[model samples]
Target: MSTLQTSINGADSSVAVIIPSKPNPLTVTYKDLVTECSSFQHKLAAIGITNRSPVSIATVNSYEFIVSFLATSWQRGIAAPLNPAYKQDEFEFYIEDIKSAIVLVPKGAYDTDAPSVKAARKFNAAVAECYWDNVKKEVALDVKDLGQLKGHSKENILQAQPDDVALVLHTSGTTSRPKVVCHRSSQMSVIDVNVNELLC
Candidate 1:
């Protein structure tokens, strides 16, 4: 019965994430994680991201990515994560196919005009830079363009339903275009059933 959002509500003081790659390892507790995710979720909903809205994430493994991914699902939106190393063509295919509402890139991506940013712009998908702001002590969402959401009214924060599609990914196709795979919100769980035994 637990959805991704419900499952994430862990002990407040427990460590949830640790990044040791930085000069100093950064640690985040469950309480901080929940607060950060809630803040980001509010930002998404305000921008008209609702159930089934696709939010493409094209950043490296980092705290910003994690927050955006979870927040997207929390808002009942689909989180389509693309490899940061993908080229513009690859990015375009995925972004276009998913019809992403917004694309989240790393800091300064808008200035450098990163491939992901260009692809998003080409598809008229909103583009934003997601990064950890040390000064603000939180993840920053720097929206460059509203794109499809221009003139869109703010949306209420939505709760995820068990049947909602929380994620959409593609299979690597050696022969043709990748196939789209949709993962339901209900699938984000801790249970693993023994199908073979049950069928017996």
Candidate 2:
């Protein structure tokens, strides 16, 4: 795996991240984040997700959602993050369009009003619920599966490259359907270079 070193709020740290997640209240190290991501990655794989397969993560600003997103990326799977405010019909369309293999719903959000849960049942996608208080235990159960994912080339997990589409933002359907935009990582690099040169 590749290692990345960066500073957060003036503190220098080295991180080996397969997926990215918010810091746990109890854990204070980059390793803790990586471990959490790894655990979620294992769980996804165990449930039969392969690289490039579509998976939807539904949550409301919780650590679980972040971990799930990172875990999907780590496994080289496509992540379709949806608005927690979506209704059943909207969710159905999005999930069907992406052909989501699974929908991850954080605990307390699985009630009838939860669009993800409703759509998951309609689309026959596998639904996995994550409880906030039980995150550690759930993560442990998937650790063994995550081990198999390590040691692979890091490049393989990336869904978008330097010149591929990075995000798919939907627009108003009444005026127009969702529009697709293409973005290149190189464009960011070029912008950075120009700004630095101007400053220098």
Candidate 3:
């Protein structure tokens, strides 16, 4: 794990992330952030998502994006964030290419009529529904039957090795069809450093 994640001290209650959204900006501390990420990681592993498996996250820019991305990383899984504005066919193409284990839609954004949902079903990829936990002020995955899975999960954080895949991004395909580029953990860790600095 990068120092960013491994250094998270749940005992320290200082604020870590402030998510500005409607109604009110949600303020999350280091403890809450770590807790939610670990929870979601187990939920993901229970659903057959393992290291290197791609999980497509289709949502607008929000706190959900940050939490889900970190949670997926915790599980040693590859996160594939796609544009929510993609049409059904566009979503289909990307999902098929990644062989995504599941497609995560935004909280309160689940609808059978939604393009992401429709495409997930067409490709036999599970549709994971998450909701914003107002009380907890974080994004949560729906994993009711995961009691046993979470219980058996190891507490040790899953650190990224130099060669482990972390993220998969696509080119604009300006010259030809879009090409999928796999980013290794070492590379992403470095990028994360700059990203965190900017966010801070």
Candidate 4:
């Protein structure tokens, strides 16, 4: 299995997450998490994200960030997580570096003027939205516009190989520019599983 199946190992009755910071932890099951990932992965593929395509998540620490990263990896694309506190130059560098096909930010005007959104727009990346659906009581992902390359069949999602890049992180870059760290499927799956187990 790849990083996409992180929570599959711990599908038992465990506290999956909490809603916001209200100290109300949500009782999420493994089957439920996998279903969400499957649904979101189809959405990612529908928006033209193919194998090796980069999808940058510019948001705070929340369920949206977790789902987005997993969905991207599930689509056999690269998941590039970014710090929402980045300034203009930092955002520009990362957006350009990854050549992201899409950028998911919090729903509403939160990211309207964000440097990350601006930089992604320069490259014509589809800026999407992630929001908490009160009715469903779940974090949902939405996109205003799909890329031109969209509309491919979602019937067959490409599987990640051991050498395929699943996650891309950047170093603080003291010597020169930020250095990108690429993690393969094997490494990413392990990292995701370990981190998810601890956090969730």
Per lDDT, the best of the predicted structures is: 1
TM-score of each: 0.92, 0.62, 0.80, 0.83
In the range 1-200, model 4's lDDT, one tens digit per residue, is 44445425545544444444555654555566666667788777766788888888888777667667777777788988877778767777887898887877777733366676676666777778776666886667677545434564543565556677888989979888888899877776655443354233
Model 2 misplaced regions, further than 4 Å: 1-28, 109-113, 134-174, 180-200
Q: What ranking of all candidate models by lDDT puts the best one first?
A: 1, 3, 4, 2
**Any runs in candidate 1 off by more than 4 Å, and if so which?**
191-200
Better of 1 and 2 by TM-score: 1
Please write out the lDDT profile of model 3 over residues 1-200, one tens digit for every residue. 45334545667677867767779777877777788877777767767666776888887766677677777776778889989899999999999999887788865445556898788777777776666778865577763222212344344446545666777899998999899998766666654432333133
Candidate 2 residue pairs that clash? none
RMSD of each: 5.6, 8.9, 4.5, 3.0
Q: List the residue pairs that clash in candidate 4.
A: none
Worst 10 residues of 3 by lDDT: 143-152
Write the residue-wise lDDT of candidate 2 on 1-200 in tens digits. Answer: 11111111113134322222456343323455556666667766666666566676666655566557556655656667777778888888887877777776666555543777778777777666654555344332212111223443333322323432222334557777664332223332343211112112
Supply candidate 3's per-residue lDDT for 12. 66
* Model 1, span 30-88: residue lDDT tens: 77887898999999998889988999999888888878887898899999989988999
